[model samples]
Structure formats: C-alpha cells, structure tokens
Target: MSSLPYLKKLNNAFTIFSRSYAFKSDLKIKWVRPEKIPCFKPEKSGDLQGFSNINKSETILEFQNSKELATADNNVKKLFSLEFAPKKCANNLYIKNMMSKVQRHELDFSTIETKIARWTGIIRALQESMERFPRNIRMKVTLKELIDRRKKHLKYLRRWDYKKFEWLLETLDLVYKPPPNHFHWITRKESLKKLTDKYCDGIKEERLKAYRLTLENEQPAFLEEKIRTLQFIRDEQKACNVVVTVTEEEINDVKNQLEELKKKNAESNNQLN
Candidate 1:
C-alpha cells in the first residue's frame, strides 16, 4: 500500500518533467518562406519591355506622316496617329527599338538578339494582359513557354558570344536568370527545424554570456580568499622554521592582481551609474 503513493508521486514527477521540456506554444520562433522570385524582370522605368518612348506622340509609323497622310483630312490624320494605333503597332515599335545596328535588316529576325527581342515584346504584352486577367490559364501557359524559350536563347548566346550576349541584355533591359544548378524545394518542416536550431543557438549564447559575467563578478572574492590562504601558509611555515613554498613575491603578485580587478569593477560600476 505504501508503494502505491510512491508510484503516484513518481508518475507526477515524470509528467512535470515532460511538461517542462515540451515545446512551448508561445515561443517567438517565426519563419516565413520567402516568395519565389520569377525568372523574368523587365526594366523599372518604362513599359514592360523597357521601351520608354514607345507610347510617345512623335513615335508614329512613317506612313502616318507620309505626304499622303499630310494632305489627308484632319480626321484621317488623327485616325492614323500613334494615339489611335493598336497595341500590336506599339509592340512592333518596341521590338524595333531593341534591335541592334548589326541586326537591323528587315529579314534578320532569326538572329539570337532579334529572337530574344521579339520574345521580350510578346512576353511583356502577355504579362500586361495577365495582370488584367490573372486566371487566364491559356495566356499564363503561353507566357511561361515564351519566357523559357527566351531563357534558352540567352543561354546559347552567353555560351557562344558572351560580349554580344551582354550587349543584348543591356539593349533589351532584360535580366537573364539561369536555372539553378540544383533545385531544393522549400518545405515547412525543414524551415521550422532550421529556425528552431537558430533559436536554440541564440539562447545558448545568451546563457553563456550571463554565466561568464557571473564568474567575472566572483573573481575578486576568490582572489582575496586565495591570498589569505597563501599568507597563512607562509606565516605558519616561517614560524615553524620550515622550507617556505609560498614566497612574498607570489603573495605580492596576487595582491596586485586583486587590486587591479577591484579598480576595473569600480570603474565599470561608476560608468553604469
């Protein structure tokens, strides 16, 4: 019957121990997965393909200002102006702006730079359209395919003609994001584990710092006790006329160290106050 109480007490103690070590619900360990960065980034200052002047009034097609249109009626001129032009016309202008001097011919659309520029124009237009209709899966798929194609072209250009690749990127204001050498999916379990480890490390470091401060604070008293013990041993040996192991020099050194430690502590305290 006495063992029953003992077993109950032991069980209670085990429960308390388990509760103490259990993960606390209120611990401030927070880990948020970063948003995935897209491979495409158009320039910041202009329309999606970085063509700032594409929408300008003076950027009309050459035919719009030809003698035929110049002599046409006012309504006809307004109808032909860039203000009334379709989005396709604006995209064409953007592509023309991206073309380099070496690839400016009308039929030179197969060059790497030209292909990238063409894809960039289409990609920007699709991106704008997607913004308006985010749930359009068809447009989204097309945009993804175009982005992948452009990335492939960029990769080839970078491998074959690095200088031209750089020039093309600068002209198009496009950033080429190469595929990662290794892909690791971000998971909640892994992130939480990493965060827990980091949090534990911080706690360990803080406790160690507090412990070091405690040892430092006790140094003066410990040194005082050591000095007194050494003095007593020396005095007892001298009175007994025995060989002295604790010399006056050793005692003086301990005293000096203790005095310096006190001075430092006092200065620190004064500073704190």
Candidate 2:
C-alpha cells in the first residue's frame, strides 16, 4: 500500500516531462526546449533501418551520481564530465589558476580546459564502466570511476556531519520534483527504474564510443599543444589545435530559453493588444 503512492508520482513525472519534450519537426518555438544544452542520446536500435549500425544506446557507461542519467538526450564526454556540485578543489580560484596555464601557453583556456576535463571525465567513466555496466565487457573502467568519484564526493563532504547530508537530501525535494508521467505503465517506481536501466546501458555505450573517438583525436592535439608551448609559440595559428571538440549544444539551449521568454512576453502583449 505504501509503494502505490510512490508509483503514482513516478507515473505523473513521466507523463509531464515526456509530453513536454516529445519529438517534433521544425519546432515553432525553440524556447520550449532547453536553456542548458542537455545530454544527447541516440534513438533506440532499429528505429531507423537506414542507420541500423548505430547502436550507441546499447553500450556506453554512466556513473551513479550523474544527473543526466534519466534524460533521453545524452552527450558522451560532457555527460561524464557533468557534476552536480563543485567541491572546494574545483572552486573558482582553482579554475582561474588552471586557466593561467592555458594563457601562458597562448591557448584559449576555455577550449583547452574543456578538452582536458572531458578527457579526465571519460577516462573516469571508463574506469567506472563496470559498476555502471556490470554486464558490459569493460566493467573495470566504470568501477574505477565509481571508486574515484566516491572518494571525491566523500572528500567534499568531509566537513559536514551525517545530519548535514540528510538535510541536503531533504532540501532537494523542495527545490526539485520529478516531472509527472501521463503514461500509466511507468507509474511504479520499480517498473520505471527497470525500464530506464535497459535504455541507459545503450545510451552509455554510445557516449563511450564518442569519448573514444574524441580521445583518439586528442593525442595529436595534446602533443602539438605541448610542442608549441615548450617553444613559446603563441599565435592564432595555434587556435586549430586549441579548439576543443565540445558539442554545440549550448546554442540550442540558449534558443530554447529565448523562445520561452518570448512566449511569455507575447502572451503579456496579447493582453494589451
């Protein structure tokens, strides 16, 4: 009897978010989508026979703490690099120091740092790929990531007592609630969890593949960067190597928010019109 209400909530969340985020052709308003470029996930296998070889949804790994784990759209390296909260070592001062190195090397710090961070995160995801994908061939990689992240999270919480952690969890609900699901089948918590897990593996696999490609390409870029830095080379010509291959997800995110704002403005104007 107690579990029934929880299922009711999950069902509602699924319905609300799904309807709000369903696929469409040439959306009339971009703002309805996202202010932040969300993670991307390839469609399920066999959705399109033309691209049958693409089975990214079946293989990649995702750590336990990742926020985008439930989202339909998932970006590989970026998702792995995504952190819910920044710890002390990851504060603004530390970031500024890191950026100084990029400046000294005459490289755009944003691009350099993004790439290095992504590299680190993917390597981390690979390290923890097993716990994330217990059944996958490369499970050890995920396990390593999980262990490392636990240490990091625990390190971050070192100053806080057990009560603080519990309070943090409680505050989350006040600030965030799962979207409601209109789909009846996803009403149960256990049922929803199982369903998401099956698809999550596939998404993780795709992310892993993308990260691999990115890593393969990173070798030459990093070496070239090292060479130029050592030689004290600083020029726009070095920008090519400096460019990090972050997905252009931020653009759409901005557009989506813009659209939402415009929509509200238009509605207000209509009242005047």
Candidate 3:
C-alpha cells in the first residue's frame, strides 16, 4: 500500500513536471554550453548538483575582444544568484514574467533551459529599471530595450544543489511544502538560508524590517528549530539570549514570499490574478 501511494506520487510528479515543461525543447537533454544545470535521463532524472560546474577553472579573467563580454561573464554568477535569490517575490515575478515576455518577443535558443537563462537576464534588466522610480509611488515601468540586443547565453544558478534548486523551483510554482518532516527537520533552515541568499536581493532593506519584528519575542522558537538541525543551542535561555540573529529584512522577505504564494494556488493549477 505504501508503494502504491509512492507510485501514484511518481506518476503525479511526471504529470506536474510535464505541465510545467510542456513548452520545453528536446535540446534540454544536453547541458547548454555554459549552463550549470545538469542533465538527467528519464531513468535517472536530472541532477541539480552539477549547477556548480559553471564555476570551474574554465573562467578566463583576461582581456576580451569586447569589454562588455568580459563584464557579462564576470557578472553571470552574481546575476544568477541575484535573479534566483535577492529579488522579493514581486521582483522575482516581475523578472520571470519579463523573461516570458522576452521569450515571446524574440527567437534564438533551441532549448528551454538556455532560453530560461537568457530570459532571466532580460528580467534583471527590467528590475534595474524599476530602481529609478521613487520609493513612495508604486509605478509600473516596462523597458523597451529591444530583445535583439540581449546577449543570450547559458548561466548556472548554483551547482546542481538538488536540495536548493528544488525549493527555488517551488517558489516559482507557489505551492511548495517541505519534504517529509524527518528529511526536513534539519534541512529547513539550510533551505531557508539558501532562499534568503538567492532570492532576497531587491527590497533587502524592507525585508529586514519585517524579520526583526517577528523575532522580537520568538527567541525560543528560533532556538529550538536551530538546535533540531544546526544543534547550536545548548540551553533555551542561551538561544534566547543571543543578540544578533537572522535580520528583519530576511524575515520580511520570507514572509512576503510566502504571502505572495498563498495569494495563488500553484499546485492546484489556478492561474494567478
């Protein structure tokens, strides 16, 4: 009976993955030249651990035919990290939606993975545009930068940290639940840290404000959770007494992400309003 539920889950996973990647191309079976994402067969499934391969010694920090090309290469890792992590949920949605728009507006890549990176960069350019707006007024500004001008290339987010990428992927879908309790008891904090590191780039100031507010009286919760996994706390009183901890910015960013997710039903297949 247990195997039956697991098999059903496997079948459902395939169905969900299929829907999510229905528009993906066959070219995805191979690694896009500079991409850090790994390839997995239908038999083995793709591995996220290979994501770190992009940082290999292949990087040439020398002069280039184009200074811009050199700059882009240097920026790829930072850009990937920022795009995947630093941005708030709104920022992430804006960037990803921007990517979808760019993909629709241009044609170059033959693979879904390649196109995802190129489009990901396209979205970053959009967020950068948003910076010019004043803080109080909420303005929606779309960049008219021609898609023909974007330098399309493969980029890796992190070495295929299957553990990390899986969570980030869930962020996109908006209906993520942790793995089983035992698997997650320790990993949740690591996963949360990865999220804040990767996706909480923009609005960092605002998010910090929120986290501090949540932690004001919640010391024991943080300590107990930390001990279960990190095993750092020796005493409940000691954990509570610690002065510095996760910032308000990190807390707010996390809450905002979760709130944005709750606003929609990703796994249930309801489209966002």
Candidate 4:
C-alpha cells in the first residue's frame, strides 16, 4: 500500500520533468533549425562557351539557318540547339572547356585535371537535377560522392602541381572548399543555448541603455535637489549656532558639475540636430 503511493509520486515527478524539458513546437528559434548548405558547384560549370567567344554567336550545323533535311526550321533549330540542349550536352561542354589545355588528346581521361573536370561537370548537372527532384535519394548520394571524389583529386593536384591546380580552378571557375580539421555536428541543444544567450544579452544591453538615458535625464534635477538640501542644512546649522557639516566649497563643486553636464548635453543635442 505504501509502495503504491511512492510509485504514483515518482510518475508525477517524471511527468513534470518531461514537460519542463519538452521541445516547444510553437517557439520559432532559427538557430534550432539546420542551416541550408549552399551548393558548392560553380555557377558557370555548365556554360558551353564564354560570353566573348566568337563561336558562341555562331550556330551549330544541326541548328544552322539553312534548308536541309538534318536541320529543322529556325524555331525548332533554336529549341534543339546547344544553348537549349539537354543537361548531358551542357556537362560535356563544361568538361571539354576545363580539360582543353590539360588533356593530351580526346582519349585523355586518366589525368587528374580531366577527372576533376568530369566530376565537376557531373556535380553541376546533378545539382540542377536535385533542385528539380529533391526527393531522389539515389541522385543526392551520387552527388555527394562525386563532390568528395573531386575534392580528393583537387587536394592531390594542389600538392603535386600547384600552378596547374590554380589554372584548373581559374578555367572551371570552381571554389575548392577543403574539409574542416574537426567536423562538429550542430546539435539543437547547443544551438538553442547560444541563441538564448544572445537573446539575453540583447535584452540586457537594451535595459542598460534605457537606464543610462533615465540617469542622464534626471542628472540636472538631482543636482539641483542636492544643492538645495545642502544649502538648507548649512543654513539650519548656522541658525541653530552649530558647526555646519556641509561646506560652501561642496556647494560650489556641485554647481560646477551641473554647469559642465548642461554644456555637454547642449553640445550633444547640437550635434544630433
């Protein structure tokens, strides 16, 4: 019978504890949410040609403005051209551009620069596909693997031939983001704690500013009241034929402080105006 009461008390305590520490769905703390990692793929990864490239203005054979069985009408040609071609074609163009100098021949796929360029092209295409179909887990995994592989190749190239590595990066317009020395998973508890501390600090700063303004506003009144009280005390002591504790020097000092404060406040107000 005594044990029943003890168990009931224990259950109640557990309920209270759980409620106290429970995550509040209603509270919208931005820090508690995971940060959206940006796609590291270069913006111009899939570009067919440079803006200033003379060839960019010329049409491909299949899309040339001519009447041929292989070539379609101008509208259809524009639609099916390299500019509007599928992702695969764009990736090929990007890879070709990157490997232009480093590649010995058309079959040179084993080189570090070529491999990086290939992976970079694929990553750019996959990222675009992922944006359209975000739920494709297989594609996401492939993209992540490709990115890691490219990073490894880049690291090797950087150590072996730094000049070539720099040239490759410039050609591809790629930014190499090295892995952190120590990987730290962002946990909700730690993030929320930091956010809470920031919030508290902001409130503390705001309150302090308000208090300071209040003190500044009351300074003149306070000094005036203090001067009156001291003068009255001195007068009363002299009238009663007693030694005055509050001296004339002290009153002069307070008056000087009040004048200085007024001058400072005026200068500040003038500056503000």
Candidate 5:
C-alpha cells in the first residue's frame, strides 16, 4: 500500500502516544495553571552545538571562495563517529554536545563534517517541526537565515570545486539541483525566460501564475494609455492642420510602450498554456 493512506494513521498514533497515560506516567510536569502550559525556556547561544559563536565563524570561513573540504586523508564515514556506536541515539546526543566546539581551521575533517552536518540537521529538524506544529516565528526567521547560509556554501562549492560539490550532495543526500544559469532581471524577456524555465522544471507554479496575472491585468491599462495618447495627438494634428512633429513622437512612444506590454503579456500567456 502507498504510504499516503497510512500518514494520518501514523500521525494519530503519535498523537495518542503523546497524550496517553503510559507516556506521561514517568514524566514530571511543572504547571503554571491547571489548564495552561507555560512557554518553554529558550536555549542560550552555543547551547545547540551549531549555534555557538565560534561554530558560526568557522562555518562562515569554510564557506569562503578559497576554502575547500579535503576528503583525501579524512574518511567521511568517521565524521559521524557516534552513529556506529552501541547506542543508536548516542550519535544525536554527541553531535548536540560537540559540533560547535571545533574551530574552522582545526585541520580535522571529522570536526568539519560535524559542523556541516550540524547546520544541515538543524535546518531539517526545524522545517519538519514547523510543519507538525506551526506558530514559531523565531524559529522560522532562524531557519530562513540558516537556509541563506547554506545557499552561500552551495554557491561557493559549485564555483570553487565542482567535484566536491557533487560529492557533498551524494554524501549528505541533499536534494539540490543548481541552476543552469545565474538569474538576472535586466530585461523583460530575460525575466520571462527565467520564469518559463522554472515552470518547465515544475517549480513555483503559484509565483508563475502571479507573474502572468500581473501582466494580464496591466496590459489593458497600457492599451488605454496608448489610446488616450493617440487621441490627444490626433486632436492636436486636427487643430494645427499640419504635421505636428512633437505629437508624432509622443504617439510613437505610446505605440512602442503598448507593443512592449502586449508582447510581454502574450509571452506570459504562452508560457502558462
């Protein structure tokens, strides 16, 4: 059977376990009120291994254009040392305790791997947690910044060492496909092409729709302005009964504007189709 049908069933099982008497039997509850649960105390900086000041600096350093992760002497498998230990959960606990302690230039591949895994794991954990329980603005902001940092690292890797970039993706199982070209929006056609390419790749459908809708709604205004400009130029020509050079220029400008708008709108519609 497909896992989709059992998703809700598993979720309900988890919910029941969290709320059951057996689950709460060994736990201690400190309550502020009979019915209300108190807010959780936030962890301080460096409390989570990857969130430490030193770890942040080292991570930033590793993401620089010149620095490259060396896997020649370092075994990638040993990076997560606690994973193969007797206690399966010890890996998680060990990572939480030690990931932030190593410096960037420590010359230890295991430490470097720990740092990389630390941020990557935190990002995944936060994303999954938010999906299950929403309304975490602080965590959401942190996750956004974390993602930006991760992107910088990816860009640096792709630029400096393509091989390492591919290897990292394989090792981490990170689901990322780098763009064929860097995005630029200097021209309308360029913007449309980028959007069309993205749509072809099955990404950002809602954003594509919004872009097309904006162009569709705005084209009529351009047409109306073009008509008004043409009428004004015609009236001026009739009043003068001669070739009004300035009016001709104005009319041409309006025509050009309308043409551009129509071209963009048609292109957008074609992409949507």
Candidate 6:
C-alpha cells in the first residue's frame, strides 16, 4: 500500500477543519480605492522638466559647524589649509602635500585618503557650479553623487577608526548621525495629521466639517431633550394645581367647624341664663 491514501485523508481533514474555523482567525482585510489615496503630483513646468534628467536629490545650503570656516566662505585655498596643508598653500602645493602623506609602497591614486581629498576638491567645484546655476539638474545630480561618495568614504573611515571619523567630521564642518538599525513601519504618530492635511484644506476647514457632521447627527437627541423638558414643566404645573386645590378645601372645612363651635357656645349661654 502506498502512503498516498494516508496523505489524501490528512488533506481532507485539514480542509474541513479550515472551513469550520477560518472565522476564528479574526483577520480583516480592507480593499482601498485608488481615488482615496493621496499622491504628490508636480506641476508641469519647463523649469521642472529640466529636473527630470536628474535622479538624485541635492543638499540645500547649510551652515558650516565652524564659524571660522563659514567666514572663510569655502575658498579653495582655505579648505586645503584647513585640511592641514602648509600655510598659504596654492592648489599645486596642496596636492604635493597630500601626495607626501601617502606611504612609500602605496599608489598615490589608489589610497583612500587621497581619493577622499580629491573628492572634496571635486565637491567644492561642484558646489561653486551649483551656486552659479542653481537650476541646472546635471550639476545638482553630480553634486549629489560627490556627497554620496564622500559619505561612503567617511563610513569606511569610521569603521576602521572612529576617532578619525569624528576628526574628519569636525574638519569638514559636517554633522554626522548614525541611522538606527531597526525601524517601525506600522506605528506612526503623524499619520492622522498627514491624512487630514492631504485631504482637507486646513485645520479650520477640518474642524468646520466635523462640526457640521456632528450637528446633522444630533437632531434626534436635541428633539428628545426638548420633549423631555417640556413634559417636565407640564408635570410640575399640574402638581402645583393639585396641591393648591387640596389645601383650599381643607381651609374651608376648618372654617365651617369653627362656625359650628361658635353657635354651640351661644346656645349654651342662653340656656344657662
């Protein structure tokens, strides 16, 4: 006998069990309509079209960490001098100093530090180009690549020597913050804010919409409260009328009893006389 018969029986049992208990899983899946999704659509402009050729996002102008560096205004000579080149170092003098720092056996072009220094020079050139032609997408893309390449070089330095990484960051006047290893995708505090912002004109508009809906849904409750209050007032007035009637009838009966007592007193006086 083959094991196929046993396998078939197990499969049938699993199918029956799944059919009977599938609802217990409490899995709810909702299909969203495409129109309900919020998307950013850039305006169609000739200037924006020039950006289509660029795939990378460039960094905006930022403050350098060091006031002295900022005052120097990113002059190429100042940058090379700040990198520990000789005083009043010209471009060729700066390159000669960088070459002297390389090991005897190491290729000048192949060293990591040499590559990093060369990339910095390239980045400064790109930065100047971008400042002149801010809307040029090609220059922006090239600047982005240079910055990215610098970051990779920094990371390699950090992995080999953390102290050197910190020194480089200080010397470059760039901020460095390591990214977190784990990220939470499901829980977001700003989702509601973003959702409302995307769909509504403003917070005031959202509030007005919410208020209108609340008024529409509250009609039944308002009517019920009005009916209850009117009925309560009517009941109170009826109770006052009943109490006044009972009190007046008792007062009239007491007056009649007093008159009868006065008549009895007068007849007793006449009989005694």
Q: Pick the candidate with the highest lDDT.
A: 1
Which stretches in model 5 have alpha-carbon errors above 4 Å?
1-114, 177-273
How much lDDT does each candidate structure score? 0.77, 0.42, 0.41, 0.73, 0.55, 0.51
Better candidate by lDDT, 2 or 5: 5
Per residue, candidate 1 scores C-alpha lDDT tens digits across 134-230 of 7888877887888888888889899999999988777776677777799999997798888888989999999999999999989999999999999
Residue 86 error for model 4, in Å? 6.0
* Cα error of candidate 3 at position 143, Å: 6.6
Off by over 4 Å in 1: 1-26, 31-53, 62-65, 70-75, 100-108, 209-273
Q: Which stretches of candidate 6 lie over 4 Å from their true place?
A: 1-107, 177-273
Candidate 4 minimal-lDDT segment of 10 residues: 45-54
All models, RMSD in angstroms: 8.1, 34.1, 29.7, 7.3, 23.0, 23.7
Write down the RMSD of candidate 2 (Cα, Å).
Answer: 34.1
After TM-score superposition, what is the CA distance of residue 117 in candidate 6 from its true location, in Å? 2.2
Q: By TM-score, how accurate is candidate 3?
A: 0.17
Tens digit of per-residue lDDT, candidate 5, span 1-273 = 599779989999989987884543222322232243212211211112222222211222222333333332234423323333333244344345444443355454454345555666566556555555668888778876766566666777678878866666555556453334876436644555555676556646777888988977987797777778777778888898987655666766777877887788799889999
Error (Å) of candidate 5 at residue 116 is 2.7
Clashing pairs in 6: none
> Local error of candidate 4 at 107, Å?
11
Mark the regions of model 4 whose C-alpha exceeds 4 Å error after superposition.
1-32, 35-87, 100-118, 133-139, 156-171, 220-260, 271-273
How many backbone clashes can be found in candidate 3? 20
Candidate 2 lDDT by residue in tens digits, 1-273 = 999999999999999989886755342322232143211111111011111122223322234345655453555533433243233213332333333432435455454333333333333333333334545644544534433443344334434555543343242211112224564432344654555676678789999999987875565456455545534433443565774433335434544555665676678789999
Better of 2 and 4 by lDDT: 4
lDDT string, candidate 6, 204-236, tens digits: 788999998787456545655655555565567
Instruction: Name the weakest run of 10 consecutive residues (lDDT summed) in model 1.
Output: 39-48
Task: Tell me each candidate's TM-score.
Answer: 0.61, 0.17, 0.17, 0.56, 0.29, 0.30
By TM-score: ranked, best first: 1, 4, 6, 5, 2, 3
